[model samples]
Target: MRPSFLSEPVRVRVPATSANLGPGFDTLGLALALYDDVSARVAPAGCHVDVTGQGAGELPTDDGHLVVRAMRATFDLLGGQPTGLAVECVNRIPQARGLGSSSAAIVAGVTLARALVVDGDQRFDDAAVLRLAAELEGHPDNVAPCLLGGFTIAWTAGPQGSDGAGGAGAGGGAGACRLEVAPGVQPTVLVPDERGLTSEARAALPAVVPHADAARNAGRAALLVHALTAAPELLFTATEDRLHQDYRAPGMPATAAVLAGLRAAGVAAVVSGAGPTILALTSIPDEHLPGMGWAAQRLAVDVAGARVDRGRLGHAERDPVAAGRKS
Candidate 1:
């Protein structure tokens, strides 16, 4: 009677992210040139991910992987499950390299799953995507920016009572925004020849930071975000942070050395997500990047977030920016 509730498979492309961006620990993030492509072909109840490209050798090949987990969770949120899903992944972004590889997968899975599960109207809501991605990534800083793109500020607040894991909003409620990336800017990413620092390694930062150090970090964080949105000239000054970078030094040897060298060379690079990649936000052009030595490659900023293509399913197109009313 309901036309059989059939929807075509979907494709999603998500960009890798560099979180922290100097002093904005667990807050600031920028989308990068590298990417992960996820294509879903609907079959008949289970979902699976096929690993290829960059992380294939190291990453898992089954449903136990983070991406598959996120996709299945998306089905649960959308009401009922489809018959099955075969996910083809062409991952160019390296895992555990401090790039937001996990966040990228989670984003692609959620966006793709949403397109597959729902009807023409009640698709994955703004809050639904954000909340689920946030919960999966363990924090909103990297996940939010990777999902929304550009420059975003987000913070999570503790619930009023013992009620756990409430998605009230991070930083500025809904905690996402669209800021135009300055035209000439190119993010020089330095991914060291190292493995990665897990989210657990990141969470191990010393809880009690000196008040003075905290203030210094706060200043740099505000300056970095403001520079990104307002004045490009302020980026260099804003890139200095006294927070997580130094604290994370012991665990990430390459990260620490890269950050130190970049700063000494006046590039002011900071730890990218969790470890071996250092990101230098600059409009200084190509010649300057190579001099820093920690670089793998350099490219322009991709402000646009994940993109999903729908073949005929309701003739829908996934709008990366149209998440709706900022609650």
Candidate 2:
């Protein structure tokens, strides 16, 4: 018998996210101009994936696909089932280049899976959807902004209550509070070809940092929010970090140089996520920026976070007006 054909595919578009800007560590993040798109298609009761862009030569094309793994894990968390799957990818964002490629894929999987199980109907709860994305992506900083738009504050537990814990989707207890987003702002993502720092980067630091450093970061994190909203000029002083960036320098030499490049050009930049991609908070205008040549690629802020369509997966429609749903 000939193979059975399935209905049209369920699409998902998860935006590229930047995390740990300066002092925020796992607590702060912003959505960026770049994106990696994932698509979930119903096939004949099995699993298959096709990866193009960035890591196509190195990434998997079958059940082992990271995008597939993320989608499956999401459904598992929600007690859903797999029918069959196919994935088509577009690689506007660079992989392993510190641009939230992994978070993008994880969000895509779960978001698309939910769309399929429910027949691509209904507006999936944004808060609940982000919780799922955070679980898979390892934090809400990157996921939340990608899903909700604008700069966001995410918290992670201090791990056994060490007093540094924070996460946006926390439980009702005092430590578990909701994160917020503001409207009408633009972002700029500056990515360099320098390789990314792995989870191992944390191993280079002492188990504990000085309280002075912690306090300093707290002030900057607050200042960053102010810069994002009303006082962008403060960013030159606001985006400094005593915690993550200096510690990971060994892993990101080019990142350091590129950051200096941005600052010298009067562009306020922080290390994107862990490192490698420097997230620059800026107001968008046709006026050109100077000394941006060092970056591998530069893009404007995209307020539209993770979303879906019939022909694509988490495929974002660019205009906030066209989104039809508020961020």
Candidate 3:
């Protein structure tokens, strides 16, 4: 049966996220205060997207857009497609700066599509949202935090939740655990002007790594959970990674140098996802210069992941320049 569409527009606020925080590659993620505001309404005919902030004129304005594609996928899951879609996006998150912009778009699309359907929640629940979003993004690390908020440990679970050890590799359902960050934990992102290709970064990583390195990463990843929640002081040691960073450093020399410098100065710094951007989990020393094409922003931890409301883009949300932080 075809699903009933809501006449009113539905909007979603999805936070920017940082994935693979050090050792927890493809498993751990953090939601930051920066966000993208997207609103969609059922239309009578064609699909149209009005993008403002980041992508603006560069992104596709039709169904080819990531947000629209996600929404179409969602509508299909909800049993039918609306006649058309009119999407408005006031994007604040950088497009390809390792800030989970793609995941944010995917989450926003799924959330809005679900809200636009009359009985959407009943048909596709929150867990289904996570699962679908993860499938769309091909990984749960970024989508989990963007959807559920805070610090999330996400993995792909096999039949009966038995695949606890799998992180996107198990290929079943998406599962995540959200935890509130410790009060003392501060997140500072050093964003660069150049964009990075996640595919390129992944290609740079070796197919195999030493066993000792994997063991070390496992221990630190475990400690990272505790440090992020209960002991901020231990974050420096806990955020260490023996995985993807070093191998991909040659491609992103600037990020590698800055990360090394920050760590030497006692800051818990890591390459944000597949980088050119750097995420510092601890306070940086005053001497550190965030200049040289790197814009540093100290962001808060967003506890409320993706928020949905029944409405179109208002004055502030349509501004394109202003980041629509929920009041």
Candidate 4:
């Protein structure tokens, strides 16, 4: 069936995310109040993209843009492509800062595409949306929290239909559980001026870890969930990671230094996602800040996640400087 498109423009607000949360590795994420506002409408001729804030000049303005590619991929899944597209992005999330900026873009694109189509939500559904976005982003950690909000524990469900007779048919897709953060759990991100690649940070990890380290991380990862949800004081002990941080530390000495300093001061801090950015789960004293080269911002937990609405970019959404970004 050829799906109908909506004439009204659609916009989406996607929250920035911090993944790993220490020992949880690729399985945990938290949605921050920081966000990117994006809007799209079907065009008559060619694809046109307008960028306002971050990555305005550096990011692509046409079909090659990450958002556009994601939209195109979604359109393909929905039945057919629109004749043209006009996209406007008022970005606030810092790119390549281990803050789930790319995942936010991908979620916005997927959501905007679905909203642009009539009865799109019915056709695609929320579960399908999460699965597709996770597939596009290559992991559920960031995308899950970006889409569903709150603190999320994400994982890839193995292939289904392995009932001895049917034999695995297809993958079960991405799955996640969202939990409310305790009132005392404050999230502060120390973002660096320089960018760090997720690939490079990942490559620095050793192929295998000792059994004891793995076991210790497992306990801490479980404790992290409890500390984040119910017991805030235990966060300092819960957020310990023996799996990846130390191995990747040499590449990001500044981040390592600050993380160690904050932890020594009894702050529950961890390398947000891959590197360069540090996420402090507990409040940090003024005396412990790294001083310069890092922008520190305390953000609220976004419980609503990605929001889609029937409208173009309004005055507030169009503002390039809003969305809790530190100058």
**Highest TM-score: which candidate?**
3
Reference-based lDDT, each prediction? 0.70, 0.65, 0.91, 0.90
lDDT pick, better of 2 and 4 = 4
Q: In angstroms, how far off is 199's CA in candidate 1? A: 3.3
Off by over 4 Å in 3: 161-171, 324-327
Backbone-clash count (model 3) = 0
lDDT tens per residue, model 4, 235-316:
9999999999999999988899889999999999999999789999888999998787999899999999999987888776
How should the candidates be ordered by TM-score, best one leading? 3, 4, 1, 2
Q: How close is candidate 4 to the true structure, as a TM-score?
A: 0.95
Q: Tell me model 2's lDDT, rounded to 2 decimals.
A: 0.65
TM-score of each: 0.84, 0.79, 0.96, 0.95
Segments in model 1 whose C-alpha atoms lie over 4 Å from true places:
1-7, 120-123, 158-174, 283-295, 311-327
Error of 4 at 136 (Å): 1.0
Task: Let me know the TM-score candidate 2 reaches against the reference structure.
Answer: 0.79
Off by over 4 Å in 4: 161-171, 322-327
Where's the lowest-lDDT run of ten residues in candidate 1? 318-327
Ordered list by lDDT, greatest first: 3, 4, 1, 2
lDDT of 2 by residue, 1-327 (tens): 112223677776666777777777877777765666666777768887766557777888887876788777756655555567877866556677667887787777767776766532333455566766777766677777777655677665434446644453344221223233334344566566556654766666667889999999999988878776676667768788888887877677767776776666666677787767677765422343325444434455566677677775333442222332222
